[model samples]
Target chain A: MSLTNDRIKQRLIEKFGEPVSGFEELYGLLSFEAPKEMNLKILQFLFDDDELKFRFLTDLCAVNYPDDKGRELAVVYHLHNLVDNIRLRFKVFTNVQEPDVFTASKLFSSANWMERETYDFFGVNFIGHPNLKRILNVDEMDYFPLRKEYPLEDQTRIDKDDAMFGRGGTIV
Target chain B: MSEHQHHIKLPEGSIEKQTTTLNLGPTHPATHGVFQNILELDGERIVSSEQTVGYIHRAFEKLAERRPLYQITPITDRLNYCSSPLNNMGWHITCEKLLNIQTPKRVDYLRVIIMELARIADHLICNSIVGVDAGAFTGFVYVMEYRELIYEIYEEVCGSRLTTNIGRIGGFERNFSNTAFEKLEKFLREYPKVLKEFENLFTRNRIFMDRLVGTGAISAERALNYGFTGPNLRAAGVDYDVRVHAPYSSYQDFDFIVPVGNTGDNYDRFLVRNEEMWQSLSIIEQAYRKVQEFKGADAEVFHANVPEYYLPEKKEVYTKMEALIWHFKIIMGETAIPKGEVYNAVEGANGELGFYLISDGGRTPYRLHFRRPCFIYYQAYGELTKGAMLSDAIITMSSLNLIAGELDA
Candidate 1:
């Protein structure tokens, strides 16, 4: 039988019940979230299970929700089971202060640089990541640039007038 | 003092540092684009290597957060400049998925034609560059003519060639001109012979085989673990193609074989890309026949009828009030997006170019992530080149098809 979303959900609930929550399907893609600490366990279950062989780590990235108080950083993983040709999105949220999730680099070699990239942008420190440093940014940089705290434009710059550039002016 | 010993005394620390450290690039011509590989060498063999990318990092994901839907198309173009039309189509498809827009069949066929042409151009360049790296420049020079011919078709369809922001959200900005069809027919008529000649030059050549065979070989197990996709993964013997697996943009309607190779070496990658070009040609021909099956008014359909997202025609904007309103609204980025997350991928020349979009019912995407395949390919470079000959490393890099623009995006 082909692996459907319901079977995957049932398998997850049977293995690690209650901790895995917020299962929803959007545009035919199965997406759900779990507590940050249980990320590796869930990922391992998904990878090792004979029925649910979601081995391929298609993509890994982090999203920042500034207003979401306790859960400020969401680390999202897109896993694919090539045999069944199905994909699912798994997410784990961590507070921005201590944004640490277990690294999947040991399981999937692709996660090394992806975790570095996630660390570079959103400052999500993957726990026990070997050589977890910035992949796409300068090493000397102090702050994560992709966070909502950092605006695209420098607010303090005085080189140009904001009024002339269509900011703080009447609607055109 | 003895005459030979007294001439010069060697530095003690210099001899202590046995292995030579070589910086292969961030600008070296053989490395092709801006990629820096710090290799520790034991004579001519690479002992260990660390790769440094991001010299051309432009923070495209950060830039996408502020831009509206249509403006991001040009941004996607720079990701894989070799196949900008594919990236443009992928972005458009992602937006369409989020917006619940259904493009017409003619539009799908038109997209397939453009995409397959881009694929041919990309593969020919990669294969010929592999030849150039292996001391054969004739094939590179020979295939450049056909690439220019493909560019001429792109020019006919879109106003620009490289970095072509070709299509609107729903479909192409305009219907295919008659001259574009003529150019397509011209390309279809002439490219196969040139490709065959190009393939003959390197496929059985003793020198090319010696240089590429068994160099940079990775097992299918390791390749998948390293997130290899597109031709690179297919070359490693796993037949996981996004077009065949996911079937987006009406790819299911077309018939084409996904080529695979056993050893996952440079030679296999070259052969896989070469076979894919033929498959792309066949797909384009089938799509062209399907396109011609439509007549008169049905053939005239180009862009989908979604005025909320698709830009209005200039002539219609001048005459029609609704068109004028939509033109202003779309241009000003006033349209609200549906709150949803959509991950849409297309078979990019390099790999599966996926767009992960999340909207908060805002004009701009709340968060957008581009699953750049070149970036993934590059992370595995150190592993691919370990203990290989220094010259073989160059061949491995070229065979992997790492575009600096896409890699550092």
Candidate 2:
């Protein structure tokens, strides 16, 4: 029998209790959230469980939520089970001021560069990462560019026409 | 060496062996694209290495946040520039999923043809470059000529060649021209013979085999742990293909084999890619035949019936006021997108090219993240090349087919 999202959710809830919450089914894929501290434990459980063997780490990325106050950064993990051909998304949000989530690099080696990339973009510092420095951005860059706090466009550029870009401006 | 011997005149216990640090290009031909690897070498064998990417980092994900759904297709072209149509289609599919647009059967079959052609084009470059890295230049030149043929097909379909933003959100920007079909037919007839010849040149060559057979081999466990996908994972003996598993873009309609290899080495990657090109050819032929079965209006139905999202016809835009208004609105990013989050992945030539799109009923995406296969696979470079010769490392990298544009995006 193939694994279902309900069974997986029940297992997670039974194991971690109240820490695991926000179970959602989006586009037929199972997605849920857990406390930031229990990420490694949840990942370990998902990998070690016989029925729920989400062994393949499909992707690791972070989403910044500047308006969420305490929970401002979300570290998302897309895991896949090769046996049943099932995919699950697990996310853990952290405070932007103290974004310290445990690294999953020990369990999934793919998380090494991904964690570094998350740090490079959203400034989510992964605790216990061997090399947690910037992976994509330059080392000298001080600010995390992907954070909502930063502007999407270059603020210093002055020789530009807003009207050409569909913004309201007097024609030449 | 004499100077070191004079300076270290103490006992053997007191002397420390120093390994040479070699920088293998952010711009070297052997490295393919702009990727720098600082290799710690003990003679020819590599001790340790650090890869520095992002020389071509354009912050695509950040840029996607600002651009509207339609405008982002061109940006997707720059990523995996070899098989840009796949990226373009992948982005369009994500938008379609968000907007709940159902494409026609003809559109799906048409997409399959273009996507498979792009896959073949990408694999040709990768496999040919592997030959080039192994000091076999003839295969590279021979296969590259066919890549130009594929580009001509792209030009016929769309106006551009390399960065082909071929299709629209609902379907193609325009219907396939007669020249396009002729070029595709010519390619189908001629490419197999050229590919066979190219394979014969390197498949049994002793020098090429020796250089690649056991070099940079990664175990399936290690590969999966590193989040490997597409050919790299298949080369490791895992039969997890997105097209087979997920079946996007009507891939399930056509039947094809997923080629896998025992050892995930440079040679296995080469073999897997070669077989995949053949499979892609078969898929394209099937899809093309299916597309030909359509008659009259059914054949002409390329784009879906979502007039709000799809641009109006040029003639209609010139003649009708409603057509002109719809065209203007669609081009100006005035079309309303549904508020939802969808993650759509396509089996790109490299791996699973995924677009994680979140929309909040805005003209632009709330957040867009591209799951680039090159970036994911390039992470395992240090593990793959460790304890291997410097020359072997070059071959391993080439076999991985790490496109810097995709890597640093």
Candidate 3:
């Protein structure tokens, strides 16, 4: 028999300890939002700790949670460690006032791009990042394309003479 | 001070040079998409690189949300334009999985032939583009000719060349035309000559080998960490291929070797892709035989409730009230697809092309997330490009095969 989802949940609780406003599982994934202070330690536990060598960051994408009562932007990290072939997910909430999450670049090199992509797309600053810059969208633009409030303008809608779509490059 | 570890291995207390950022492609042919890569250079080498997108963003995900389950088929064609049939099949099969519709044995075999054919087409482009980026343009022309031959077969069935919306919900919308097999047979017979010709162009050529053999190297460990899949993963020496590991569609019936490279370098990527194309050809040959063996005059594939979405045949609409009613619903795209979510993946040319479709019991898909191989492969570009010769950068990027629609979407 394969490792059931319940067995995986029990394993996470056993490792993390009795719940104290932390940890939830959904859709075959165990997730929790940790405070910025203990974020690094918690991640180390997940990646380096004997039980969970969550080696693969299968997807480290950010999801904007605008209506989450109090939170402004939430950074969602999805991981899958093939050692056990189990998937894990976690989120770090960043409100408007403090939009920084401790960088995981030190833990996994791939996180460098993942973190930069999140920062580039969601404006969730990754503190302690060695080199962070805009990726995938035009640098001249001030707004992030993935942000909900940002206008989803097609190329035709913008003036053809505009720099981004200009024959020379971004029309501005 | 070599400074090439793929990950951030910056010197302690590194100073950010008052670097001027140059945006490449948002017009640069080399950026491969409508991607604007903001590169800050300390002289010629990059200090930092950032990629910005949406310039070419058609927002296929948003587009899928508006169209019916079957309507989204063509949207996937744009994702990896190199092999539209594979994308279409991947999207449709994902729907099939959610609907739990078992395609007839004949339908499975038909899909295998088409997907494998697309695979050969995809690898040829990838390998030839790598050759082009290395300044050897002839190889590109050679592979592209074969790609055209594949498209000719595509035209025979779907009547379109590049964007062949060749799949329906449960199976193919139509049968493989006899004309398609005739073209395919001729192409297969001569593809070896062309493949051998391309082999002469690069495999033993001293100039091509020097540029690619050890340049822009990645390890299986690092590639795995980066979530690399498909040819890129194979190039890194991981024998894990989705087609073999998790056999979906009728992949289990086929026997094929997953070619991998010892050193994950540009040259190895080229070699792996070259071998994979040959394997794809063999798979196509075997599948073509099976396709011919099928005695189906009936539609080998059943569709999602056609009454609501697909246009009734002219005769059916003229005669049957049920089909006519269904025809109106289909034209308006008012029919509901099964209410569920599924992530169906196929071994696409680039890698495992997975489609995650969520239906809210509506005509259109609620959310469709393409597990784009190019997007996943693009994650390692920053690492691969670092410290490589500036000329090698173009070759490395092309080998990465970052299709814009998939990347931006």
lDDT of 3 by residue, A67-107 (tens): 56457776666666665666666767778557888888787
For candidate 2, give the lDDT of residue A95.
Answer: 93
TM-score, structure 2 vs. true: 0.95
Per-residue C-alpha lDDT of model 3 across residues B160-232, encoded as one tens digit per residue: 9888998676665556667987998988999988998999889989999999988878999988877787888
- By the lDDT metric, which is better: model 1 or model 2? 1
Candidate 2: which pairs clash? none
Cα error, residue B32 of model 1, in Å, equals 1.2
Q: Return the DockQ of model 1.
A: 0.53
Best by lDDT: 1
Chain A TM-score values, per prediction: 0.90, 0.89, 0.75
Error of 3 at B117 (Å): 1.6
Instruction: Name the candidate that leads on TM-score.
Output: 1
Clashing pairs in 1: none
* Cα lDDT of model 2 by residue, B1-409, tens digit: 8878677566565347578789999999899899899999989999999999989899998888767788999999999999999999999999998888999989999999999999999999999989888899999999898999999999998899999989998999899999999999999999999999999999999999999999999998888988889999999999889999999888989889999998999999999999999999999999999999999888898999888888888999999999999999887777767788888899999999998888867667878989999898898999898999999999999999899989988
lDDT string for model 2 (A1-172, tens) is: 8888889899988889988999999888899998899999999999999989988888889988787989999999989888998889999999988999999999988888888899999999999999999888899999999997785666555432233334333555
Computed on alpha carbons, the lDDT of every model, listed in order, comes to: 0.92, 0.90, 0.72
Stretches off by above 4 angstroms in model 1 are: A154-172, B1-12
Query: How many clashes show up per model?
Result: 0, 0, 13
